[model samples]
Target: MRRSIGETVILRYWNEGFEVQLKCQVEYIDNRTQMVIVSKQAEVLNIEFRNIYETL
Candidate 1:
């Protein structure tokens, strides 16, 4: 799978914080499987859903 900037990553907002999906937005391409995801609208950044790269 290939993920690029402006691409929406489907993630599940989790608890704890940064553990699972945070319903975050693609902030920037850090590398390949590593990216900066921001919190979803109306929700605070707590956990990360899943850092998965989309199929390109």
Candidate 2:
């Protein structure tokens, strides 16, 4: 699914050899690069669109 800015989503990634899931807000998206920027706990993350497991 296509996500837009300001949308709330769940982001999952590997951290410390463990899969971590975080609920974050979409801050920006680069369609050409297929990259998304999300903010969680004051941290901004640059993640690939494919890395997004799901949108909520």
Return the TM-score for each candidate structure: 0.32, 0.66
Q: lDDT of each model, Cα atoms only?
A: 0.43, 0.75
lDDT of 2 by residue, 1-56 (tens): 35457888777765446666888888988889988888988899887776666565
- lDDT score at residue 37, model 2, on the 0-100 scale: 83
- Report the C-alpha lDDT of model 1 over 1-56, residue by residue, as the tens digit: 12534555555443444434333455554445454444467553322225432322
Candidate No. with top lDDT: 2
Off by over 4 Å in 2: 1-3, 13-18
lDDT of 2: 0.75
Q: How much does candidate 2 score in TM-score?
A: 0.66
lDDT of 1 at 23: 38
